[model samples]
Structures are given as structure tokens and as C-alpha cells.
Target chain A: MNAIGVDVGGTKIAAAVVSPEGEILNEVRYPTQAIPPNRLVRTIADTITEAKGDFEVGGACVAAPGFVSSAENKVIFAPNLHEIEDIRLDRELGSATGLRITVENDANAAAWGEFRFGAGREFDHQVFITLGTGVGGGVITHGVLLRGAQGAGGELGHVTIDPDGPRCGCGNHGCLEALASGTAIGRRAREVANERPRSALGRLAIDRQVLGEDVTRLASEGDEAALQVLDETGRWLGIGLAGFVNVFNPEVVAVGGGAARAGEFILEPARREVHLRARSPSRDLVRIKEATLGPASGVLGAAALARGEDGEYVLGPSKRVT
Target chain B: MNAIGVDVGGTKIAAAVVSPEGEILNEVRYPTQAIPPNRLVRTIADTITEAKGDFEVGGACVAAPGFVSSAENKVIFAPNLHEIEDIRLDRELGSATGLRITVENDANAAAWGEFRFGAGREFDHQVFITLGTGVGGGVITHGVLLRGAQGAGGELGHVTIDPDGPRCGCGNHGCLEALASGTAIGRRAREVANERPRSALGRLAIDRQVLGEDVTRLASEGDEAALQVLDETGRWLGIGLAGFVNVFNPEVVAVGGGAARAGEFILEPARREVHLRARSPSRDLVRIKEATLGPASGVLGAAALARGEDGEYVLGPSKRVT
Candidate 1:
């Protein structure tokens, strides 16, 4: 059945009318507003309605950032989006558009997208990691989403890498997110550039502000300092991946997000460290690869949720739709 | 249905006739042999026959140590038990005992036992950790065992904790098993006792070889060095538990095995460390408790497998019985 999928981000909201086989029939994007919660709900509803047009839709799903409650169909908390505490996205949007809607975490949605239509399509068990500003991931085991009892699982980024390392956004110390994320890479680059002015990264920092992308570019150019930074961050990613490999024993680990765009510079070192640290059986079989869906995963996963085919997290029909 | 359950360990084999509600009707134990594999199979079958006596049984299960092939109903590998590679336990035991049989991993069996009749009975999602010689665990998520694509998931103890610390038996360095297991605890205790000869643990070390149990006894008697040893090992366990909490987000983490008999000496310090390292939301909800089933978890879990009421790891019907 055809359904609409909405990806609600901090800066923008993207919606797509997805066919039964997961092809996007139509799409729309709108700038997200820092408005009251009710208005934001309307904005999401308006976007989904516009994307639907005259096509008969079976259902819809909105992929929202932060903790989406599988039980309540609400946004429990979104740190990036202020004043949206426990917003009932499914109920409000379903009422506004006169159609049922399912709500899921953005990372989970992306993972579902990959599992169903992208890199993880061939594997029944996979760990999908998105290394953007901060690390985010989703776990699919036996082709089912692992939403914890409180719908707060798959928080791979917050797992500790070093007990005595830097502080993390989750108020913990030395989370994988604090060491291996794009933000972490940029921070390390700036620190190294400031420490050694004679290095290529330092020269770039002196010439202008250096970012994670600039470090990747310099590393590709064979700059020792830039390459060192990538190696260090990649090693941390590998160390954390080893723990996940041991715990979940997934068939493949798909790396996505902005930092993953560094390509082999990050993955090569990660593969080395993973081989060095991970145990047998799992380490021997697991393949670490780049994610394939790119920007479309979140929306497509939401659409899959809308169709009630999104793994094991059952989203019952909305009473408001009736 | 009533079933016969067997637990095969490196040193001994234990068999029991279990009632429908998991009660032990009769039990027997036999020393495991290092002879040819076929002789060992007969020993297991004889013990089960003796345990069953006149009681009628529907099916039987043998929880073998090492990797169990859920599809083949065979022991893939048992490192401690030589020449048993790919031995079809179900075929031999079923034919000898005249009953259908299922084969399962020992750790998986223990976890199923806990999930069905022990500490995990109240929680649908639980992580069962047995801190014995090496740390062994099983994962039950959403009331189903999380058997990975290769039936090798839930290798929790092998997860890397200190990337540069001691080498593990699995050939990895600084795994949780290398840091927090009973063997690790004993090794640490012996090292400490040797270093500080004036302390209580040191005196015991000078008199005789120190064991993990000696450290526990001394710690209970208020020995500073022994207490410190327990605290150190317990803290490492806490650190690993934090990572598991973030990864699985299970409702409860039940700590079992021989070392767990130390009671609050290990648990109190572990609780403190877990609270310190674990992140919010999930950290607040998870409960770390001691396992309740003791040595019976293995046999009981095997019974669960024989009844075909265990988690998602599907065991095919016995060929001999058919």
C-alpha cells in the first residue's frame, strides 16, 4: 500500500509519498520552525497532506529526532528541538491529515531504511551506525528492530569507550560519541592544529578555521598530522565497534553519516583496530561497510513504518484517524 | 510436558527428569570422560536413563558447553572437550534414551532457565551474566532469545573493555572476561597478595596458593587488600554493565556464576560504578540483581529447550525419535 513518510529534523522537515515497494512517488521539504508544539504539529501535518495530494494513502509515519515512544507514539524528548516535550506526533498529525500515522526515532528509521532497501538488505542481523555530529545507531536482529522496553535502545553512541576520557553530551564520560563522532574529529583536529603549527592541519587552522572535512581532505593529501587525527578517531570507532561486535554479533556493520564520508581514511584504521580487538567467530564473519541510503533512509524507513512492515515494533492504528 | 534435561560441563555431566513446571523429579551426575566421543555419548544417555527411572518423559535436551548449531542439532566446537567436533548429541542421546532431544548452548540454556523460572521471570527483557571461570551470558529481548544470524550473538564477556590490558583466552586483549571474570579476579588477588606480604591476603598467599574464594572470604572478614581486589574487579564489571545497558537496554541485568557468591562485596561496588558510568534514562531504569537459580539454571533451561518453549532459537525435531 502507498503511504507518506515524514522526516522531521532540527532545520527542515522532508516528506515523501512512498509506493508499496519503497519507491518515492512524490516528495516535499519545508524549513522547520522554532514555534509552539501545536503549530509544529500542524506544520508536519500540512507537509504530509501536501505530499499525499489526491493519492489514496493507507497510512503515514513521521520520523522524529530524539526519543520517540513506541508505546505512546510521541516525541519523549528532542534536545535539538526546544519546547517539544512528549509531543504526540501521531495523534496530532493523524487528526490534522485525516490518516493514521506512526512515530519512530530518526536513527531507528534510518536503520530500517537501510535494512529494508539499502546496505543491510541482505543480512538479517546488522548494526547501523551513523557518525554525524554525534554518533547514533540502530540494531536490527533477526530482521527485527531492537526497541528497548522504554523505546530507548540502540543508543550505541553513548556506550563508553574510555572510562577516564572526555565528557559526553549524555552527561557521561568518554562515550563513543565523545571520541569518534564528527564533532569529536573536529575537536581533535583543532587541538592538534593548535599544538603543532608546523603541520599541514596547523597551517590550515592558521589560514582559516579548520573543520572535519578539511582534515579529511588534508589526510587524503597525505598530511601526517591530518592522517594521524583520522587514525586516532578511527581507532576509537574501531574499539567501540569491537564491543558491539561481541555483544550483538551482527553479520554486518554499516557506517553512515557525515564523518563516514571520510571513506577509507576512517574505515581502514577502524578495520585494523577491529581485527586487533574483536574476538573470533564474530570478528571473522562481520563485514564493516559504508551505508548506502544516504539522505533518503530516514524518510523511506518512516514510510515502511507507515505501511506496518517496519520490523517488529508494532504501531497500532490511531484512534484519531477513525 | 515432563522432559529429561542434561548439562554437559568439562569436568562432569548432570542429568535430571524435570516436571512440566520445571521442578526436578529426579537427578544424577557422572564424571565426564576424555575417551572417544561415542563412549561419552553413552555415558550421557546412561545418566539420563538412570535419572528418568520409571517416569515417562516427552522429550530431552542436552545443554552442551561451546557453540551449538541450532539448525544441525550438533556441537560445532567444544574447546575443553576434544574430538567432539560436530557431534550430533540429539541423534545419539535420542536413540539411546528412546526420546526426542534438543541441543543448546550451555550459556543459552542458563539464560532460558533464568528467563523462564529464575531472576528474569518478572522481566520480559533481561541480560543474564554468569561470572564463573570466564564471563558467560545470554540475552533475552522482548521475551525472545537474541540468537544472531549465526547463532553466536550474546558473547557479552568478550566485549573489549581495556584495549591495552591483559590478553584474553579468545586471543583478544582487554576483554571484559580478561578484567572481570573469576579467573581474572583470582589472578589479581594472587598478584596483590604476593606484592603485599604483610596484609591478610599476603599471609594467606604465603601459607598456600590463593584462590578467588579466599579473596572473597578475606574481604568478608574486613581485610583491606582483599576488599580492594573485589572492589577493583567489581568496578570493571560495572563498566561493562554500563555498555550493555546502553546497547541492549534490557529491564534487568542478573549477575550469576561462582564468583557471584561473594554477594554484596562485589555487587555494592559494582552498583556504585554502574551508577557512575551509565547514562541517563536507561541508567535510571535498569536493575542489576543477583541470579536466583544457582546451578539448576542449566538443567532447567535444557528442559525448556526440550519442551520447545525456549526463546527464538528454533531446534528441529530429533531424527532418531521420528
Candidate 2:
């Protein structure tokens, strides 16, 4: 059996025709129209149609950025994608594509992808963290995704690192997302540049908006201020990861997202901190690794959901079109 | 059937005759002599002998303050009880008292007690933390203690809250135990008192041995320095709890131990921090409650273990007690 996976991001929609063994047979990509909810559903339908040309589609799964209510197949709240609030995305896309559709949060989808075919391949309990614009995570315990009581269990980024630090979008202070997230890193770099005008980072961003990439680039070039900023970000990441380690004690933690691309520069510090910070039993038992799917992780994860391997979508009411 | 429970602490050894329903029929207590390993086992046997006069003891469970090897039923490394390392306590006590004996880590016993008859009665998944001289915890998932691959699953107190704050016994810095445990609070209070010669806490600690009781006493009486110490401790507890919330997402967190007796002074701040710090899903789904058993919690938990209702200590060797 084959399935269609649609990854709905802020900029583009990517669709993949995936097999049971997690192999991708065919794929298609299209710009996600900056339009109304109905149009977005049409775009998803069109992308799925293009990807379904060479294989018989069993079911379609969409990985959306938001608080997805798996029970209702709706996007309850997506701060990054504000235009699709409360949209019955699965239903609308299913109606347009003439197939059954299952919708899930992107982070959950990525976790399933890792568990089934990537770094967490053989592990029954796993956690996946995506360190993109903000940190997002998904948890799997006993081979099942934990979607809490209200489909909001894996909000790992929101766990507080410092109570008096910067305010997060979730109305909290010193959250993992607010401390080590790409956005937070950029903000911190910009603040430091303004405070210390003599630093090289200050010279680079004289007029343009400072980004996390710029901070990483300067840190790589041996700027003490830039190195300090990355080190601080790594420390916060370690703090958040230590918390996750204590609670879940998962066998593996697969790290994805753009910030993680900095590799050992960020992860080495995080690993050291986690070892020093997490409870001994959990810290000693857990394995931390970079995500195998890279930028394609979310799409592969969404594909796994389409294949009915992802726990959330499988445990819910979604049907197969075969 | 009736059973005996022995709670072996650094200062005292408590034993109780417990019914199948987790009720204590008779209780006995004696000071724990800092003697040789064989003598310690003899003292435990003596306590069981004292309890057996009141009931027909079918089995006995002892909650020891260290790691107990499941394969050999031996005490591994009890730093607090250094004289008892590698001793086959269960076998020795069982032979001496003519009853089946089982040994478990004290924190695990407490968690089982809560799960069977205390605050965690209704939840299948729970995490119990006792904030005493050190932080100790036990995990129950699917009505079973989550003993890790190495029989060291729930060491919650050792999770780091601040990587740079203070040195911990486990050679780590800023552990939750080092920040919020009774020992940590007292140490912090003493440090502050030493720094400020005229502080109320300073005057109260004549010998500079600032115990947890003194800090709680002063904080309750509106002492500014003591309140600051408690508030800081609560914040660390909240941070660690928030991490647990994200990882385990247990239905309830039962807080026990000496420091917890401060009630709202400690619990309120921890609760507020959890609400402010944990992921929205965990905060909304999980309940944070103080231990209902109070000081007797350890003994009751130990009794529950003996009764085989706590699930950590079944009667036969085939069951591999958690």
C-alpha cells in the first residue's frame, strides 16, 4: 500500500508518495498560496493529486504547524499560520482530493518519522526536538505518541529555563523557546551588539536585521561575544533537554530544526550540560543524536502519518482510502 | 495475609504490621545504630520480630536508603549508610525473621504507597518526589514502577536546575537536590546568614548549623532572608517539576519529604512556577498535590510495598519487584 504525505509549512507545501518501509517513490512541491482557508485546502488537494500519479494513494496525512485537534481534524491555533485557525483541514482536503485524510501537529509527525525510519528506528520510547524558529518537540512512549488530554502533550519548547528571562509568545518567561530558539538567539545577538558597540557582530549588523545565522557565522569566526551568545543558548538548550531527560527517560532524543544545523558547536555544549544537569539514571540511559531527515524530516514524518504508522493519527478516527 | 514494612533511614528504623488493604495494625521504631553491615541487618531483623508479635507476617518489605540490586537482593551504594554496601539484607533478614523479605529503594516504596492508598490512588501513571535531605523520586506508569534498564529509573532530585549554582554529591553542579532539598535550603540559609551578620536567621543559628526547620520557622514568622531562601527553593522545585510535566505528563505529582511540610510556603510557589513554566498541556492535565501521608508517608509506603498492593514488591521471585 502507498500513501500521500503533505507538509503544510508557512511558505511551501511538499507532498510525497511513501511506501510502508518509509521509502519515498515520488514527490511534488508547490507554493502555499497566501489565500483563504478554502484555497489552502485546494492547494493541498492539488499537491496530493500530483504526487499520487504513480501510486495508488491509501490515505493522506497533513502535517500542519499549530495546535491540531486530532479528534476534529482541525487546526485550533497556529501562531505562524494565522490564516488557518479552526479550519477543518483534513475534511476540506479530503473532500477536495477525494480521499481520506489525517491531520497532525508537525512535531508529532517528525517524531513518528524518526521512530519508524530515522534515528529512533528500533526504540519504543523516543523524543524528537525541532530547533527551528522556535523549539518544538514530540514524545513517544511504549511506541505510542502521548497527545495528553487535549492534544497538547509535547509542547517541550514552552518548559521554563529561567523565570526572569525574556517573555515568550506563550506569555511565559525564560522558556526554552524564549532562551535558545533561533528567534531568541537572534534577539540576544542583536541586544549584545547594541550594548557592546566594539564587537565585530555589532559591525556586521549596522542596519540590517540580525538573524540566528549571523550569530552562528560570527561565532564560527571566533568572535568572543558571538561565542558567548551561542554558549549561553546551548546552556539553555541543555537545561530544557535535562528537564525532558528527567521526565521522559526516553531511549533516544533526535534533534532536528535549523538551529541544530550548527552541529557540535551547539550540540556539544548541550550534551555536556545535559550530562551535568539531568538526573543520573536518565542522563546515563539516554542517547542524543542529530535528526536523520534534516529539512525533509517533517515531510517524512507527515508521510509516516499517511502510512498509518504515526500513533496519533492511527489511534484517532482517520480512515484508509484503499 | 499480613506483612511487615521496615523504613530504614539514616537516623531511625521504623517497622509496621500492615494489612492487605494497606492499613497499619501496629508500628515500632528504634534508632538506627551506625554499626557494621551485619549489625544493621540484625537490627532490621529485630524490628521485624517486634512487629510479628502483633500479626501473622506473610512477607516483609524494607525500604532502604540506597540502590538495591534486583538480581542479588543486595544493597549497592547507600552513601548515607556506607556500612551496608553489597550486603544481602533481604536474605539475611528473611532467614533471621522466618518471613519472605524484599528490599527496594525508599523513593520507589513511597511512590508505591501513594499509588496504592495515598494521593496517586486513581492514576495509572504517576511521579512521586520527596524533597528531604536530598531529592528522591519514583515513577509509576501503567500501574507499574518504571525501573530503568539498570534499576535506577526515578532519581528525580538529581536533575539539575542550575548547571553553575552549586556542587552536588553526584559530582554535578546545580542539581534539583542541591537547590531545593532540605539540605540545600538549609545550606543556602546558612550561607546567607554568614554573609549578613545581623540577619534574624544568623542570630537563630548559634552554631551555624542552619537546619531546614529553622528556615521554615523563620520564613513562617515573616523573616525576609528566610522567605527569600524558600521562594528561591520553590522556584527551583517548580522548574524541575515543569520539566517532569513535559516528559512524563503524569496525571499527578505527589510531593512528600520534610521540606514539603512547610505547606503553601513551599507548595504554593512550586505550584505557581509549574503553572507558569510547564507546557500548557501538562499544566492543564496534571494535578500537583502535597503528600497526604505526611511524615508517616515513608512508613506507609513501605507497608504498602509489603502488602504487595504497591506493585513494586510482589510475593514471588518470578515477579522481579521494581
Question: Candidate 2: TM-score?
Answer: 0.79
State which docking tier applies to candidate 1.
Answer: medium
Distance from true location, Cα of B61 in model 1, Å: 2.2
lDDT of 2 by residue, A139-224 (tens): 77656665554566687887766657789887777778998888988998888888776788888768788888888888888887
DockQ of each: 0.49, 0.24
Give the per-residue lDDT digits (tens) of candidate 2, residues B1-322.
7767788888898998877677889988888765555487787788889877957767777888766654456677776776667878766876898877777778888887787778887776677999887898987754556554344557787765665668987677777888889999989898878766577887876666888999989888988888888888887898888877765667889999999977778888888888877765568788888878765666666665653434344322211111
Which candidate has the highest TM-score of all?
1
Candidate 2: pairs in clash: none
Please provide TM-scores computed only on chain A for all of the candidate models, following their numbering: 0.92, 0.89
Question: Candidate 1, clashing residue pairs?
Answer: none
lDDT tens readout by residue for model 1, B1-322: 5777789898888998887677898999988754455577778888999998998877788888777776578888887765456877677777888877787889988998888778887777788999999999998877767767666778889887777778998888888899888999999999998888888999998888888899999998999999989999988899888888877778889999999988788888888877887766778889898999999999988877784435222222211100
Most lDDT-accurate candidate? 1
